[model samples]
Target chain A: MTSRSALLVLADGRFPAGGHAHSGGAEAAVRAGRVKDAAGLESFCRGRLHTTGLTSAALAAAAAYGLDPAALDAAADARTPSPALRAVARRLGRQLMRAARATWPSPRLDALAAMYPRGAHQPVVLGTTALAAGLDAEDAAYCVAYETVGGPATAVVRLLGLDPYQATAVLARLVPEMDQVAERAAAAARQGIDALPAASAPLLDLTAEQHAAWPVRLFAS
Target chain B: MDRVSLRATARIVADADGGLPLLVSDGPLALRRTRAAGPYTRVTVVGAMSAPLGGDRLAVETEVRDGARLLVDSAAATLALPGRSAEPAAYDVRITVGEEGVLRWLPEQLVSVQGSDLRMRTVVELAPTARLVLREEQILGRHGEPPGTLVTRLTVRRAGRPLLDQELAFGPGASGGWDGGAVLGGHRATGQLLVVEPGFAEKPVEPRLLGENGAVSPLAGPAALVSVVAPDALAVRRLLDAALAELAPF
Candidate 1:
């Protein structure tokens, strides 16, 4: 039986997926003075959710809906223009695969891991994990959409030492928008890969590249 | 505004006469073969009249045959103005580079004026040994005015494999938060430089930042992309020019 609680577990911050090391460009944004407080963080997350967040959620939903993983990997690469971001996705994918395999054993995950031993895109692996957990495409999309902002929110707490409750409140306010974005993503996935959203965050792409070159940065990207 | 469907074609092929490139032009896009001091054929795009108004379907196709080296540029910036009909203007550019061919597509900036809407698509296909240096810049609006809606997509394929495919949107009707702190950050001018050299396959480029607003990163293939968001066109050009000099020198 498909359990809805699996979505909660997958979306949880303590999923052991190596996501704690990354800030999804929040580190760069914070250092650049674009994000200095809760309001700034909210604005930044909202921007990311609609652009890269929507694109990623759709990719994950498509993979969960049984689209070809290889093709989706190529599409993800095309959508991600920054080489640094690409490396981060692959690394996070490898880490997520390791954790998901142990949590929910499946031959599909094994096949994907074998096909891309180094790693695939994180969203593709995430969708495969959702499939293994007997979850639907919307579930996968929800997980990605939430994580898209959650990663930054948590990182900003540590980076800026802002109030944790305030950070959580920022995420709480985005809950409705995240649901709308997830629904849009699931619908977009049904339309096929070509119809997927190509929304881009150029500043995120630029800042992520700069973050990767930083030797003293706390986040991986 | 007059709504018209126009298609223009340009072709370049290297001949036995000292490897000089052949040139062709058609319709509103007048192609003039100009003399250059370097070992390359230079073609200038002189606009026959104001074009790319809304509700217009326009296309410019250019091909570089094997063993040819071509450089293409425009005389002035292309302005997208509003049309009477609500239909958005479409501008399509198709470029092909054959084996051992080199193409430098350095057109002037494209400015989206107030109340105009445009959708532009640029597709490039390159052989395995071909080299390309392409630059694209977009100005959101005229001075002190908010921009109209504009969307652009660039797709490049090398040797039957996808190298890069990206789409950017701005102004009204685009997805929300495009001008927010995480996307354009209210920057009016944005541009990128793409350099595809087969030699990079052996020694890939190292990712780095260009000043405060630009970044250069290597693609999955033998190419490098430099993206910048700045306050104006001149600032955008400065970073792109620096990146071009570092990535692809004459």
Candidate 2:
């Protein structure tokens, strides 16, 4: 079980995982008119959590439980099609690794740091990083779920110019769904990646590509 | 879609008089085939953003048997045409590669045209020793403009438990499916996803990151699952290279 304090920290938006730097595609979604105010943002977040979140949570569990981090990492890499976004994962990964190591401090973290010297995606690194930090499989799964949606929700506040309260309301409403997603992910984590696979939507795929070439950068991607 | 069994609508007949099927026959999503052994059917698959309707949906599901292999291409760079009714275009695709079956599901970028509403579900189940290669491309916005609003959902499940389930609600803020750095980097314009199973040229499976374009995660196994989401084919190609390199390894 993950301590409530640890869960709070893991769930915190200011934990320095470099999550703030990413709009979770919110900027691009806004640019595309796919996401507007908090309501629209919620829908986008829900879609992502349902599809992409489900996959990432499973992979994070794979990393937490000691599955081949490399294999799960590879799968996560494959699932993310946007080159710009992928670059963001590696960069955020490097940043999070730096942060996790400093906050937790451990040899296993050292091993992962050595594995991907440049950086690992937040999911892959988070799975193991949470384990190293003493978060359980369930907690790790929750972390992945929260991070997946929260990043964009935060971005929604900035991109849509909605009231922070509105953003918080939307996120709060998604809690039940997030719990369901985490539960499903936790279940898959027990089975391993072979027993589990991921599927993602295609428009998001193209959006990443389009966002990648944007001359001006709002988010890392 | 438990309400629907992928097998109920099986075997796409190519011709009469003991001929192959227009679409491949699939059993529980895996590969299957029955050949009178003649010239097989060929179909081109291009990009599509919204769910296909009428003949277009049929085009999306058209298949050729083992005795059949399609050189898939696109029709005017597929677009996600908006729907007139509330129902999104539903695509149910089943492919069976018996002994030596080959079906290529490839297409150009799928552009989600403005005011397009779509829903596509592909239930593919491959046998233990089956071989397959499928490519799915989807793009948002028409001519660089985000298509007004729509709901495009994609779900692919194998052997029961769930492989991929995606729902893209583009209308008001009512849909909740995909978001996060894990997928589109929180942007919206265009995105494409590609996945392939085992059976490619032999290589030392060492999955490595190729260009600074993105990161690569190397899979260690006989099966390879690759996905590249990009705004255009070029970016998808870059992602494909990194993914292939990672999946095939050195």
Over 4 Å off, model 1: B1-28
- TM-score, cand. 1 vs. native: 0.91
Across residues A73-152, which tens digit of lDDT does each residue of candidate 1 receive? 98898788898889899999999999999999999999999999989999999999999999989999999999999999
Of the native A-B interface contacts, what share survives in model 1? 0.65
Q: DockQ: which candidate is best?
A: 1
How big an interface RMSD has model 1? 1.3
Q: What is the lDDT of residue B197 in candidate 1?
A: 98
What C-alpha RMSD separates each model from the true structure? 2.7, 9.2
Candidate 1 DockQ vs. native: 0.66
Runs in model 2 deviating more than 4 A are B1-103, B106-250
User: In angstroms, how far off is A136's CA in candidate 2?
Assistant: 0.9
